[model samples]
Target: MHFRHQTLSSALAMMASLACLSPLQAQTTGAQAPVISQSDAQHLTAAPSKLTLLTLLEAAWSRQPEAQSYTERLRAAESLRAASSAWTADSPAMLLQGKTDRPGSGAGSREVEVGVALPLWLPGQSQRATALSHAQILALQGSMKAQRLQLAGLVREGWWQTQRTQTELALAQTRVANAQQIALDVARRVKAGDLARADQHQAEGAVAQAESAVAEAQGAYEASLHALRGLTGLLDLSPDNLEATSEGDVSTPLPSADALASDAPSVDEHPLFAEAMAQQSMASAQADLAASSRRASPELTVLTTRSRGQTGDPYQQSITVGLRVPFGTGARADARQAEALAAAQEAQAMTLQMRARLQAQAASALARLRSAHTQWQATHRQAQLAQESKNFFDKSFRLGETDLPTRLRIEQEAVQAQKALSRARIDVSAAWSAWWQALGELPKP
Candidate 1:
């Protein structure tokens, strides 16, 4: 009874598995199954501890639509590579022509020819096929590299955006707190006849304005988190404290421009360029195949036949050497070959142009990084001075030595200084990202 119960349960599970494998769902790739909207999936996963830049990149690689596309392309290339190396069979053929004799009164007969052939070896066919397959493998690797770099850049940028929003939100909250304290003091002074009712009203207006700014900042912060979570597949992203001190030896001493340029590979080696080159190579191979189709190849043929005419001698056998010559497609083969050569030349030229463009972009990105680093140092010093000034003004205001307008002005200056500092950090981070992209190093493990 126990065994029977277990068997029944196994059957039920098998049925459930079959049901889950719906035709429509089965059609989609596993990688494509993660198509749930960012908002919907956000709740499904727990927030990770200390989510680093690499972790975010990995998540994007797993979930992004472009990743799926590259993966599918790689699979297709592999399948094609296998097909190119395998043997294939052609068609069966037969022929018959005869006339029947009626009771020995009259008789008529005619001869007929029939044959069957298969490819033995076509010149340049195997070499061209192997080269095309190798090219495709290299092309697919290049595409995968490109996709990884893109995902890394996106994740880093999203991380910075979220950080910046959090910084802004915190600053806004500080302003609101200060404004509230000032409002309370003015209201007390008005009740004690030390300040006018108009001053109290101005303080109240300032408080209201600060509150509105806080609300706006909070909204922006939340939006940034949502955007980040969409990319990283991490839902509960919250603002964390940023590093206050700069790490030592932040500068990267780069090699000479000539040296760097010399290290760069040719256009055919770059991912997109290589893919295009591979495609052109494949086209050329296909044209060669078409040309080969016009030539005849030797094949050993053997046939066994059952003749219906003679009752005693029904069995017959024959052996022959067979060949096939393409009758009409040779001219078309030349035309296709010419077309392929033109396409290959075009791809080569495009690759050269792309390499030039990529080099220029790399140079620009490096220059930008240097400029951003210098600017950030200056901005950091300015922020420090602004903070000191705000502190001085705050003390004076508390001692009744400074007016409300003067205090507000100092606070605004400090706020602007902090914002500039944040922007400078953001700029430096962006420059680093661009530099990585130019070097094709963003997706490196």
Candidate 2:
């Protein structure tokens, strides 16, 4: 028994390990193609503990006015769906009448009739009801999907902006340090009678300029952080809480246009598209129901009545059947049916149009990603070249082979090149974000 228990424990441990590792492995292998990761993972000063994308999504879902409005509409649709199952109700009704006439003879007559109007087997009622219920569910699903997509895009935008600003801030700080060192060197040279007072003034001016630029960049960074906080609803979001990671490869050549179009609307497998399709089905069902408005199912009703007369017993028992068929002056049924059909047709057309648009959107996103990646590569190379130039110019200036102004210019150019490279990296990230949004994916925390 002890050995068996040990075996069971070992099996459980293995299972737990598998469970933990499987998802991470899948993420790395592209088995589940999630959105790109940002730097949040590497720089987290503290675990969010209870914070998660789900928590944020839920909060937004609850607070958003559009989501709330749609929820009410969804409830109403559900009520209608329930009503469709049992469309007819039965009740007994009573009637009384009395009359007297003057002359040679007078007579009075009264009758009570209890009847019920029963709806017959509706031609398309059952199917229509089912379709409507399904459609409503789909519509709600779509609304939720749309809300989440919007939120995800916003979060990614904020995240990328914050990262970009932080990178710029670092570049700006480096510029300040370089300028300070140059000023110090010039000051020492002037004291040693190797450099003139004019050169010292130029170095001091460059230091002040670098300081101002750093201050501006810092302000921009702070503003970006503020935006990130607002968008994510996390007051404590900072560079310390983020991890830096790349979007890997966005440069895989895309498939042909024909191939892309072929899979266009197939993404209806997506929840939103599925919901839209369901709504179209419901509209079709509604059209059928309107066309068959004049039809009803058979009904059975029982009734008991009481009556009073001059010379007879006043109690009566009876069973009655009632039937009603609407005969409108115009083609009301036809008109209603036509309206539903039109709605369904419109929904179908929109779905097709959206599919075409989605394909175009995806293509555009991919193109941007390619452009951003190329830009990043070029800018990175340029920064390297600038660094080399700055190093050469610095040594030349120190050896009295180059003037102070020329060295300062080289340093400034190097700073610009570094800033450009940082900006390009951020652009690449933003392009990946756009691609993710287009594909209906969200970055995981």
Candidate 3:
């Protein structure tokens, strides 16, 4: 009795799977996916811990050497800012002099002097240098933000792809199980003189094909999982609820094209846009500092000397002050200034380009989101129609009215419809993720 119930359960499961497998679903790439290694499969099954896309990005941030390098540059810029003041422009220099002479007559004469020379900051030079340092720091901050945003996009896409392959694998496995049941049932009927030998053979061939498809889907899924792990830098990885969420149904209809159009222009205000502006500011500040530094600072030296001679000779004292200023060469100074000015102009051009690029990115993302959502709706309807057709074929097969080959054909179509619907749902989520990323919704991580 227990064995009979188990067999009945398997048959019922197969019935449902065949009915759901529409042609569109069957047309997905799982059967044609590249075969991965056994080791890869083993590596993927080690579900270490639950992880979300956000957490993955944060982990990636800690491991980003480029971001760290930029941070170090920012630190150096801070030091430069501290050194931009007039007092820090150059260290005070001390001058010392000593002399001793033995005259043909009385005593040896000795004199010692100490003097300090200080470089004076030109009126606007200190402020200009400080501003330059500040601008560099701002640029570094903006660059870090852009780097992180780019990293987040890669990881996000990887995560969604993993979900895609994983879901497809399950669907493939279901098809394999259903085909096996059909083969078994047909073989039993043939032995009992209820079905023809040709029917049994055809059903057996389907099971073989379905098993091969399962292997391909498994390999593709494991490969995708490995890629996700490589990007996140985790010792071990696990997928969270992204697959479920992405494949799940939406409660409301997607937005209209006009709404998306209205929202597209706002992505220019993303953090990446700010980064380009910061780069421009840094270049402009560099130009300002170069112009200010053209005028060299003057040095002032103050000295005092005292001498003693004979047993009770009065002490002799002298004081001296000197000022020096060196003129800058015109060719070199002008060239230096021109270089900075050119950099400023280049940076300004890049800033404008970045704004346009971001706006375009946002528009593209919005369009994809809408298209995917619409595809999901259309494919879902196809799936339902396929299901109804599969139901009619299922009834016909059970009554021995439809041959095994005809029934198998209908089942394959139903599976394709299932696959198409699943892919459409996954694409919708993927499009939404992309839209958010393009708009610089990637936070600090």
Candidate 4:
């Protein structure tokens, strides 16, 4: 009980804090937000415990309006089978008639009759209607699934972006520490007359520049985090919640498409395809129902009649049978059948269109992944070369063999190379994410 109370209080506090922040400030933090450890990925403060990507996705799914709408519609559709009459008329109706004669002749007479009629269904109309409702419910289920896939896509995109931001912030902090250390070393060298005063000044300038970079990186990270929160409607989401890739993160080398091909789900497993199939079935079912409706079904009625005869006349009681059939000129039936056929045709066309769109999307994402993977490899090589060049320049500068400008240029190249490499790796990861989405293989809530 105490633990639950504590958790509630903590959540309330967090909400209060969030409420205090304006939308603008959410993106550009005026106060320091919680720091994330890119190394361990643990939250740096006391926060909601045991939050995971799956849990967050589930929470967001519950909040999604479209998903909820389809879910409700499915339930309603399911209930329709019961709402529909198993037979055409749920109950029987009563029929009564009476007649009276005035004293035009020697005797006056009065008579009355009472009867009951029971309605019935056609041969198979009741069953067909029930089946049609079930088909509609199935289509609604597929629609709900498609909506969930959309939500999952959003989560994946935001997850990768947050991963990139976390890595960038870490890199920026490391750069700042390195710059500060170099500045202190230069100061000592200048004091010992081993380096020029201008060298020390340049080192200090680099330290200041690094500090500014850290601030900028921090801002970008905060913005990305805010965007993720808005997208998922889960403010407690963090880097640790996401599934770590095989190499551990967006910065790591990911498996090639060929490596994953064997385990990859086929395009037929996609939600778009499933949804289209369901809709096509629903339209076809509707057409069947319309065609069946063309055969007119009339109610079956059973009745008992009671008659009171006039004075001096014999008492007579007899049962009268009747048939009621709805007659149509086939015009209405043709119009309805034609309308249903048109709808089925439209649904078939839409299914084809969706397949074409998915195929195009899959192809585009695959091409991007291949190109981005190659570029990431090239950037990795570039970083290695830049690191070696920076080392050579550092040694020469320390020995007074390289000018300050030359040394500064080499350091800048190394820093830019690292940044470029980070961006390329992120691109590859994002492209892979898109590929997965294109295949409609999103992780379910």
Model 2 C-alpha lDDT per residue in residues 1-445, reported as the tens digit of each score? 3553354345345434434543223222212211223554232222243544444444444545776677678787777667666655223334343333322443333345544445444567566666667676766767677667777777667667767867776666566657767877787787789999888788878877976876776677678765654454454544444555534333444334454456433466554455566666667766666666543344444444444353344545555544545444356656667788898789888777776676677788778877888888899899999999999999999899999989998998999998998788778777877776776665554
Residues 21-83, candidate 3: write the lDDT tens digits. Answer: 653244233244334466655533333355666777877776678866876787788888888
Model 2 per-residue lDDT at 10: 56
- After superposition on all C-alphas, the RMSD of every candidate to the true structure, in Å, is 15.7, 14.8, 6.2, 10.8
Candidate 1, 323: how far from true, in Å? 1.4
Which pairs in model 1 have colliding backbones? none
Find the number of clashing residue pairs for candidate 3: 18
Q: Compared with the true structure, what per-residue lDDT tens digits does model 1 show for residues 220-254? A: 76677777777776655543222221211135554
Compared with the true structure, all predictions reach lDDT values of 0.62, 0.63, 0.75, 0.70
Per-model TM-score, in order, reads 0.74, 0.74, 0.81, 0.72
lDDT for model 3 comes to 0.75
User: Candidates sorted by TM-score, descending order?
Assistant: 3, 1, 2, 4
TM-score, prediction 3? 0.81
Across 398-430, the per-residue lDDT of candidate 4 in tens digits comes to: 787887778778888888889889888878877
Candidate 1 local lDDT, residue 441: 58
Residue 386's lDDT in candidate 2: 98
Query: How would the candidate models be sorted by lDDT, starting from the highest?
Result: 3, 4, 2, 1
